[model samples]
Target: MNQPWSGRKLHFVGIGGIGMSGLAKVARSLGAEVTGSDRAQGGHDARNVPAGATVVFSTAIGADNPERTTGAPELHRADLLAELTQLKPTIAVSGTHGKTTTTSMLVHAMPGESYLVGGEVRSTGTNADWHEDSAWLIVEADESDRSLLKLHPTIAVVTNAELDHHTTYASSRDVDDTFAQFLARARDAVVAPDLTRLRADAHVFGEYDGPLAVPGAHNRKNAAAALTAIEIAQGTAELARELLATFEGAGRRFEVVGTANGATVVDDYAHHPTEVRATIEAARSQHPPRVIALFQPHLFSRTQREARAFGEALAGADMAVLLDVYPARERQEDYPGVSGLLVAEHAYDARPGMPVIWAKTHATARAYLQRALQEGDLLLTMGAGDVNAIGRDLVAHSEPPGR
Candidate 1:
């Protein structure tokens, strides 16, 4: 378990992003020099970006203010399409939801350190690490516009197939077809536990005899895929199950902040339909008292695609709080078609147990929760964006039971 790669150079396109930054950190740990450019800079951009890696600014930088970037990497972002076209490296991870978490898991679990593009590496306390002369270059392959198909990973792991990036794919089948193409590029494709056919030509990795510690059944599938990928990468499945069982899971992936006033506050980054369903089901598996779900929809397009699904998922909670959509990278103009209120209305009709409540902002949502939630309730603030902040604030302000 000596550090795999101990010296090299790596660069990232969107280093400020959580997934991107996590990759940078892992690369640095492998002993590679790291540098990155952010469209806009934030606290995540300017602070603790490894010791030697330079921060470049990109032209995609918007007016968001907090994450401002210098103009250094402006040309780089402008010409990234051409630049990445030429910069060849080793190993790239391609997928949507589990890109960061699973990439990080593979980086930590697998042998032969790698240079990750947008994966979390714990050794360097950052994302996008650089290792020396390593055969592995782990990257999160985004399926937007079939971009991931460009990558050539010796071993590829597909966590799950879902309809994402509506701005790109026309339909769910298109997304799957694109993924099928990506799988075609890999020498060996690591598919989920239940997938039987898996595009025929590619080799599918099998599950070992072991139980994963990760909460949800979805994670169990993720674990199986990761294990398969590791087996392909390192040419050994030895101790893989042991490593998987010890995994505590990534940050904000159903992370429990603390308990308060006889209630438990759990935070998770579950924005998509499949993710939301898995997270809530995991909460229910624990059989917690009165599950209180505080959900903030992530994107306008996503909300529209899965609003009905979202409603059905939230209905599982004993009490649910629905906040306005968090439009992080998208614009408000796109959201009028798919509002959080619409999602709530649909979910209300579907579930007969606890009613889904709507709030315009976090303040109103938190206020509603403060009044409604009592002892023995599990308040789960779940989303991919900033929704976890509400759960943190709630835990901070609430008093212990009988205090």
Candidate 2:
């Protein structure tokens, strides 16, 4: 069957974004002429855009963007997924956390299954893939903008639920209710036992005792969910477990960027408090020595809502460095008194014995980390924002130990 997007010229406004880039790659793979632009300098550029292409923009792109004024028909990323789900047997993974990891695992277990994941699968080197003749399609259903509701998957996987995206959800209950609605629409689902809204055919799974390449108990739970989905798809769980044991994990999910001064530098996308705690615990399990964490809060709204919780999570680290808030799409002026300092203050109050340093800028934070990081330590750069760059830069600039 010919792909519906074949012969179409597509332009993505913010192609550098994780989700947008995934869609762009899928479109290109389907034989569409694809080009893109991002405000950031290094991503897609104007030179690559074809003449008279259909422009697609995410919510982050402003009306004033040149591509937005091109008068091309606009399509949201979610709209594309909705159209695809209508045509394929979709398995959508939706949750407040572990969605990417679970989706990647399913893709690994079932070879040749088309997928649209939010992060790059280290093994595959791309986030999204197109298999024109495949019967199944897997995706990371995002709940941040309530976009997961648009997908109608044959099977859904909800890892766990928590209150996030303060702008979309009114309360924790609202978040849970939204997830329940998403699951209700799916033909079948595999969820964590704690989710508790399973259908007759739906399955609930707990931790797996089998060996896994990824660290942490949470990953064990993710592996269990993936195994259940594989079983439902009529695949062998034993084979899946063997494949999972060799999985290198998705990018930015406990990715080991490099090593410096005898300490391993890890980059992780963990913004929520629950995620933060899990990532830190994973680092401790691997390193066993001092775990030095440098966290840059992702959004102002999230920081304002979960400052105390974030502080408590950071306290688990042997030493914590709080960088300035990334603020993604929000203006700093709109959310006053919401910054790294707020988290530092709360963490100090909660765990006075553990040291928390508030470094308001990247320069200060980098200097502090260089001086503080020593042998037998794990340096974890954690957040949902661009803080991952700091870890890469630190490794790139540092000399080998004993230089």
Candidate 3:
């Protein structure tokens, strides 16, 4: 099954990244010699990379990176993923929010298939796996850089499409068009009812009226999408529905850290306004006395473009704390006058009486949260960055004496 990748040597320049690490695991299991390096230097992640291998990198790796100048041939990450697609009938899941969870659901429902997901699958304890004897490959397709267009999937699944990457796509229409093109290239497509406006001929997945192991109405919809995709590719959803009930979901998709000070701490990767609102709404299902949202806005452009929407989403929480914009791959100087306060101010206006603070520093944000959180409260951290560490710390400090 891994004919082309057998015995091949591949070194990942940024192996710690969820996508890269998942890909590396699958390639290794398929008989590729895998090695990896990360910006973490000699830390645990970098030290764990195989001793030596030929260079492999992604679009995120700059040409000036020392690893890129090794004079050895290198492979693009996306290109490697496309090669895997050639050997198996691929089920590619792409959407603004639920792609990771949806892909993980499909993999968990239908076992013994190669899979590459952006986040760790809770049930499997890993993001990607390889099965030489399986006939399928499940991938969490990324649309941020329009890279999802490269793979030719046997069945393409779109949970829903929206404008999330402000830089890559100029408008929501561009996002829709890209998804339409993606669906058009697939042999079959299972899409959200909202997406029918883009591709009517594509199968319109019905909402699953069954129970789910995961929380959130949004997750129920994701399950429906996964089951529908399974039905299309395999002609049955009977067993898939049962398996999905055991699905714990992918990491950072409403993951709960232990309780801290009698309050539950949950973490989520919800940078967009829609995701933020949905996650908070899901938390409300726990029926906590109060929901405290600790959010770190991801990009300057997104915070600027969706500040009001972000505020509206935050209003769903009982109280909210906003950390400064996390300028990932974007410089603060380039985004002058744009910061998390933009959203915080809007949040303040959304509910003048609600407590909303814009903490410019992570330390201050943590301190504020530590002081404000109370018993019976639920702390839900949301971001695309490392904000989950804060929730973990809170849980650690509140743990009972020695284990």
Candidate 4:
């Protein structure tokens, strides 16, 4: 009775990442010698990766990273995830949208299970948990890196598919084809209505009208998908539905921070145009007097390619504030003339009379919001970057429970 990774030594290159840290923790739980280093976590040799320890790296890790100099064998993060998935009955959730939320929902609705989500779960306050005796495992399968293909799960759920990774697949059809392959390899699958045809044995979940603490039509769809997978796993959905009734949601997915300058500050990890639009619409659904979207563009490539689309999405909000492109791994020098202002201008054009402001920096954005917010208004901050910090700063003076 040995774990698959028992006695193996693994070093993660960017261990500070949410996903990488989760994998490292899980590997350690399963009996691996796990060491990791993040440049931001102070420059140490990842607590010293021993000789011949296999180095595990993600797509974001570069070739020149010091960890790769160990001269040891290398493993992709997906391969490690595949190893973990094979250890138990896995319920994998993948999609262009709703993957994190849906994966979190499954973890919440099912008890006595070990799970890992790409984003931290609000209830658990961590991205992963390891239970030595659990009968099941829940994973947030990532389609962004095309790594979902590496997993072979007992049950798979694809909330929906669309082309958001500009650097990965060439077109939406390529996205679909990849999803179809992921689903085909699963023992059973629940997919979006449009994707049921991708896998002959795939299932389309029934419409969910159940009560949920999370808002949005898209989340309702996500709930339906999670419920369907739970039924497939346990042979019934009633209990799962009961558990989901009070689900609080994962971090940064419509998380309301606190009252800041009379406006309620909400933070979300909605980078894609579709997600942005959905988050805005979901906020509006709660009957807030107004939904002001303060969005920071994540990447230069994505912002350049989808500026207009993002603008259109922001049009769904009552007012829009734009911050400069975050650049992430992409350099601004590589893509000239692409900035958040481009999207702000496009947003203004999309809605002839709507107001749009390009704050250009977080400081300017925060100052403007402080002067502009009003009671009954919801200040929603959306992005994949460190934009949530601004929302937190806005509500810094507020007491606990909301901050």
Query: What is residue 369's positional error in candidate 3, in angstroms?
Result: 2.3
Give candidate 1 regions above 4 Å deviation.
Answer: 1-15, 20-91, 115-125, 133-135, 193-198, 205-209
lDDT of 4 by residue, 285-397 (tens): 88988899999999999999999999999999989999999988899899999999999999999998898988989999988887787777899999999899889998985
Q: Which candidate is the best by TM-score?
A: 4
Q: Candidate 3's residue-wise lDDT over 1-403, tens digit each?
A: 4355677888888889999998888888878888887887553233343445667787778787777776767778887898888889999999898999999999999998889999999988999998878989999888998888888899999999889998899999999999988888789988988789777888887667887877898998899999989999889989998898788888999998888877899999999999999999999998999999999999898888899999999999999999988887788888889999999999999989898988877788778777777788999999998799889988888743232
Deviating ranges (above 4 Å) for candidate 3: 1-3, 43-54, 399-403
Residue 398 miss distance in model 1 (angstroms) = 2.9
Off by over 4 Å in 2: 42-52, 198-201
- Residue 316 shift from truth in candidate 1, angstroms: 1.7
TM-scores, all models, native as reference: 0.79, 0.95, 0.94, 0.96
Worst 10 residues of 1 by lDDT: 70-79
Which whole-number lDDT from 0 to 100 does residue 286 have in model 4? 87
Clashing pairs in 2: none
Per-prediction backbone clash count: 30, 0, 0, 0
After the best TM-score superposition of candidate 2, give how far the Cα of residue 330 lies from its true spot, in angstroms.
0.4
Candidate 1 vs. true structure, TM-score: 0.79
Clash pairs, candidate 3, are none
Decreasing TM-score order of the candidates: 4, 2, 3, 1
Candidate 4: list runs displaced more than 4 Å. 1-4, 43-48, 398-403
lDDT of 1 at 299: 80
